[model samples]
Structures are given as C-alpha cells and as structure tokens.
Target: MMAGTPSRNELHEQNRLSWNEATKAHNSHKGDQAKFFREGGSTLFPEEIELLGDITGLSLVHLQCNAGQDTLSLARLGAIVTGVDISDEAIAFAQKLSQESGISANFDRADIFDWFEETATAGKQFDIAFSSYGAVCWISDLNLWAKGISNILKTGGRFVVVDFHPVAMIFDTDWSHKFSYYSRNRKCTQ
Candidate 1:
C-alpha cells in the first residue's frame, strides 16, 4: 500500500457516497418509479426470471440491491425478500417505494461484506441469494464476497449473479478500451 492510500474500507465508503449521489441522479431520469412498480412494472429481464423460476415461499436476499426494484419484484412473486445496499439514500428510497407500491420487503443499509458477516453471525440464512448487473465490480475481494454469500445461505441455497463480463469493463461506451479489467486495489470513480 502507498503512503496515505485509502484502505479497502475507505474505498467502499467512497463508493457508498458515489452510489448515493448516483441513486438520486439515476432516479431523476426515470419518471415516477413508485407509480410504475405500483402498476405492476418490473425491472427484471426474462433471463433472470427464468433462472429464478418458482421462488414463491422462498426467503431471498438481494445483495447490492440499489433502490430495490428487482427485490420488490421478487417479493411480488411471493418470496420473502430483503434488499441490502451500502447507500443510505438508496435504502431509504427503497423503503419508501415499498410502502408506496404496497409491496412487502425489507431494505437495509450496510456494506454487503459487513452485512453478510453480521447476518450470518446472527444465524440468518436465505434460500436464495441474488445480485445483478454492476454488483461484483464494486467488490474489493471476491473471496470475502463468496465466503460471505456462503455463510448467509442455506445448505441447498442458490446463489445467482447476473452481471456483465469483465471484458465489458475494458471498453467504454464508445467501444474503445478505456479501463483495465483489473482494479489493482485502486478506487474507480465515474
């Protein structure tokens, strides 16, 4: 580590701030999300839906669930859903959305790694653990992430991650290579 370099916890705190700001900006462009979900709209794609078929009565934990649209969708499908995110703003909005949309779900604000440890120590386990899209890229340690997931899941529980390939991170929106596939322990800022 370099002199005065941010630790992994510091980097994650930075990411939490960034995602909090991003949640506000991202929601600004999407008109009336609560109304949409209230009207039975879902953000889930067909592939993920197929992969998570028949989740009714299952307890599912959504890791890195930003604003919890998919988590609420899972709840609507009769799963007992809990969504966890590091961003407090996102979790607040998710709770509001749950109330407004009349969907029953739990939203917690905590870094996923820490939350996993706390939840696992508290003897909590889920039948399904899910994460999607940009989730893994934010993680600083895949081994910890995997172990955390394992600790929080039931013996036969399923862990599903639907995310973009690392190759996709190499290219910018213009299809030009703009970033390295590896993090190299440095914080990434947008």
Candidate 2:
C-alpha cells in the first residue's frame, strides 16, 4: 500500500481489462484453439508432458490459463482440470473451446491473488498447480502467488512452471549485458 499507488483491486481491474482485450486479439491471431484440438493437436509441449507424467484421474489447477488450450489438453489426458485466468474473454473462449472439443474442464475468471480463497470457498483443491510461458510476469507479488499455489494444492502436490528466462527477454531488447542479472529471490523491474 503506497501513498498514491493504485490498490491491488485497481491493479487487478486494470490487468483484467488489458487481458480481456488481449484475449480477443490472441484468439483472432492465433490459429483457432478449438480447431487445433479437434484436429488432434495439443498446446502442451513434450517437456511439460514428460514432467506431468501421467495425470490420469488427478486434479489439476492451471493458473493464468490464457485460453485453456493446455488446460483442455490436460483434461484430454484424463486430469480433471480447472483453469483460472484474469480475463473473462479468455474464460468464455475456453468454455466454448471445451464444448467444441468435447472435453470437460472448468474455467474461472479471477485474478491469481484471489484463486486460493475462491477455490477454497468452493471446496476445491488440486494435485497440481500448472503455469507456462508469459504468466509469471503478470504477477506483481510473488509471495501472494506462492501462497495461492500452496493453499490450492493438496498434499504431495506439484507446481510446474515452464518459461523462458526473464533475462533472455531482457537480452531480446538490445543484446547487451548492461542490466545486472540475478537469481530469483531478488526482484528486478523489467
């Protein structure tokens, strides 16, 4: 809480609005998710599949599941999957994709910070908390994100995060080592 900074609610609302717009743009630009699934395509990479290693009958929670492509893929692999995203458009598209793909999954539109409490109130817990590229950067507070994951997971649960190094993205900017690269504990603005 800063003297004049936007509140968490305000930040969430801002993110929601931006992601809602991004969903429309993504759905339009990216090849149809439903079409890809209907044609036997999976949004999951081989490494994630190997890491997940047989999710049959397991409960999975996908945080920042943009359009639920990977979430539905997990469902197709027999995991009871629930996806949470900040964008209503993304959730709606995911629901439609589920219907079109004839796969079963649940989609929720909520900020990641509220995920644990919301799912807890619904009496839902999961065996895994999954996220992939581009999701971690959306998190302004890592502690809250960690707490959310912890609260949502059952015993022996796993948290799987697969993404490019943030430093690599920095390199993508100007190909220079001007900025100091550090480990995860310290926070750095991009």
Candidate 3:
C-alpha cells in the first residue's frame, strides 16, 4: 500500500510547489476551450456520463477542477456547480473564461484537504460531489478523500471519480513486453 497522506501543511506546501508556471499553461488552454470541449475538456466521457443518468437538477461540487472546464460542463447540464482548486491563478482564469462563455459558477481557491476541513456546514450539503481525470494521484489519502466527499455530500449523494492511476499498466506481464522499463520510467507520470 502507499504511504499515509502528508499533513495538511505538507499538502499545501506541495500544492504551491506544483503550481509554478502552471498558470501560464492554464491560461493558454483557455484559448482553445471550444476545440478542447469538442474533444474532452475534462468533462464526463460519453460512456461515464451515461452512467450518471440525469444530473439535470442537482447541486454539484467539483474539486481540484482545472480551468473549471468540467465544472462548467456540469452547469451546462443543469447542475448547480462550483469549481474549487488550489491554484489561485487557475481559479481566476476559470472565472474569466466561465464568464466569457456565459457560464455561471462559484470558483474558489484552496487546497482540497484544507478546504474540506475548514468549510463547516450545517445540515445542508451538495447533491453530488465529483472529481475527474485530474484528481486521485495528486494526493495520498483515499480514506480521507472519501470522508471529505461524504461530509459535503447529502445523504445518498453520488460521488464520481474519473482518472487514470499513474502506476497502472495496460499489460505489465512478460507476454508482449515490447517497451523498456527505462522508457516507462522516463515518461511523465503527471
């Protein structure tokens, strides 16, 4: 099993470390959102979306949302969506582009761990909570992640996660082993 997740302090530090020049990249991607969404734009894939059935009238919270693409996409689907991410610059760009596209959403900046811990709520919560494609490997605590989702989710709320495990191999067996281990090691895990 993997190690226990780092403390909130450590995660915050790492979030900062990971965001260097990331703003520039997110900003550039905003230019191509139209083309991007035509492809994927972090939204639900056609198959997984079908599994969601109808989200036409639910309140949803999207965590670690990059550039707010998926969050806005959900809003387009009629879910009241909020986008949260650790990158301040990314959140800002998300807001700007969202406004540009006439999509309305609340965007906030905070580490997911810290945000969940700090945002106290009463009996109310979102109808659904989601994170896709770009979550998971960014953190180390699946238990805590589940707990946080549970906290912000209403009774029987649905939580969806879509992402690839960095360590997952299509075929790691000896059969048809064509690539060198060194090549896989040199590939970008993120």
Q: Tell me, by TM-score, which candidate is best.
A: 1
**Alpha carbon lDDT at 190, candidate 3:** 18
lDDT of each: 0.89, 0.83, 0.70
lDDT of 2 by residue, 70-164 (tens): 99999989999999998999999999999998899999887777777877777778999999988887687788789878888898999999987
**Candidate 1 lDDT (Cα, whole model)?**
0.89
TM-score of 1: 0.95
Best by lDDT: 1
Weakest ten-residue segment in model 2 by summed lDDT:
181-190
- Please list all clashing residue pairs in model 2, or write none if there are none: none
Tell me the lDDT of model 3 at 188. Answer: 22
**Over 4 Å off in model 3, which ranges?**
1-8, 29-43, 122-124, 169-190
lDDT of 3 by residue, 49-145 (tens): 7756688888888888867877888887788888888877778777876877677788888777667776544444788888887577565456787
TM-score of each: 0.95, 0.87, 0.74
